[model samples]
Target: MDAVAARSGVHRTTVYRRWGDVGGLLADVLDAASDDDWQPPDTGSLEGDLAALNQEIQTAMAAQPPIMAALIAASFRSEKAADAQQRLWEDRYARCEIVVSRAVRRGDIPPRTDARRLLIAATAPLYHQLVLLRTPHDPQLPGHAARTAVLAAAAGAFAEPEPPSADDT
Candidate 1:
């Protein structure tokens, strides 16, 4: 709040009055940065769906590296960073979850599968490895693997082939 107030030339009290303390203010900003018009693509298959989802994350992270930097820096010392990260994940992942759930409902995915884990596996490694890690991060490393390895892990992990029947013969 102090930093923001200082930057904006507004009183800390004024900022607090509008935003309800620093965490709320940071959450709002983080939510906005994480969710800038990102919508999941439904391509009628888990592979395509995850691929599109990966691209959406890459695009967002690419556009707003500063948001990642801020969150990463804050994560070092404050609970606010964790809260901000959780909110950011919910906002960003919820869109993809809705799309994945559509697949589940349509019988493209197992009804009991864990969509959140699938998304995290498919999506997080590449985005975080690239943006949050140092070189040999290669930038290229994630893009190539993201489309195949990462997305495949997501699809396969969450996709149940079908349960064996109690009456298996």
Candidate 2:
């Protein structure tokens, strides 16, 4: 209560009066802490596609583990953190859904493509190294490894089918 009031330059009584208690203030802040960067590359080539998307995902998470970690720790004590985290994760994956759907419509990706898995596959090796395996999230290593794994998985996986000309099927 005191900490929240101090941070916000408000009286503790004011915060308590508005939110009801210290837990309420914590819950609101946790709900509001978001680390989202919603932009995907539209490079003409799939290789560019893999690189751009993974970079956004991998770098953003690595750069802000503290907020995520803090929220997770607080979630053990507050439902607000859990609800907010779930919502944020869904929104992040929704961006992947858009990428996959657009690629399928344009014949740039296979009809049976799994955008969610594809996004994860691109990131797995990097995370295995930097997180699971406890190696540093070496900017160079993750960037290179992510691009390579995704492109390798995608090679011949989704070649564009021959399109008919205006005159022919």
Candidate 3:
């Protein structure tokens, strides 16, 4: 806290009064950092759009600093960090919904496709390899992930659940 105050040239009391604690500050920073006006580009097809998004994710992941790995790991154990991380991911998944919705409108995917699940399935492997395994980054993983997600969605792997019927109840 003192270091942050010193670096930012703000008084410690002011920082404390404003943020209350490190978690509050982290939440604010994460929220601000998560803001992006860029939407998935319309590449004329769902596959094309997904490929573009995959490339973007790969590029961004490649550029992340080493500290991000530690931060991601810590978020799992820390309540405040976990909350912020969850919010960040929620925002990301919401953004990805646009792509799926567009695909539905284009008749490329079923209207009942679960966009959030598809997006998570698409990116989880990459994140697992990067953060959990700490393995060397695979340049081809993003493309493969996107392709897998497209295939899964086409196969109804991410389809919405069927509504309950009165047969049993």
Candidate 4:
């Protein structure tokens, strides 16, 4: 708390009052960290967008591995951290959803495609390398992640389940 207070030039009491504890502080930090130079790209194709997003992820992970690592670790044990992490991801997925919806409209991918799932699958590898394996970052990972998602979508991997018919209910 002192470190955060010193860095932000705020009093420790104010920080504690606002955040209540380290979990809240961590949550706030993680939420703020979500802001970056990347926006989901519109390259006239789903593949391009995913690739762009992946590249951005790789760049961010490389630049702030420790912050990412700390957030991921805290998420497992803190409700505040977990909610913040989930919200951050939800916001990211919402942006990526635009690209998926565009692809659906263009007939490039199937209708009712699960955009959130697709985005998660696409970036899973980079997160694995960053938080779990703790391995060196790879710049090409974004392109590969995008390609894999495109392929999976083409194969109907992220297709949404059909809603129940009226008679079935």
| Tens-place lDDT digits, model 2, residues 4-72 | 677789898998899774445555764454343555677765456666766665665566434434544
Worst 10 residues of 3 by lDDT: 64-73
What's the CA error at residue 161 for candidate 1, in Å? 11
Of candidate 4, the 10-residue stretch with the lowest lDDT total is 60-69
Q: Which parts of model 3 have CA positions greater than 4 angstroms off?
A: 1-22, 161-169
TM-score of each: 0.60, 0.57, 0.75, 0.79
Range of the 10 consecutive residues with the lowest summed lDDT in candidate 1: 134-143
The most accurate candidate by TM-score is: 4
Q: What is the lDDT of residue 129 in candidate 2?
A: 68
- Residue 110 deviation, candidate 3, in Å? 2.0
Question: Which pairs clash in the backbone of model 2?
Answer: none
TM-score for candidate 4, please give it.
Answer: 0.79
Off by over 4 Å in 2: 1-7, 10-37, 62-65, 75-79, 105-108, 124-134, 152-169
Write the candidate numbers in order of decreasing lDDT: 4, 3, 1, 2
Q: How accurate locally, in lDDT, is each candidate?
A: 0.65, 0.60, 0.75, 0.81
Better structure of 2 and 3 per TM-score:
3
Give the C-alpha miss distance for residue 60 in model 4, angstroms. 1.9
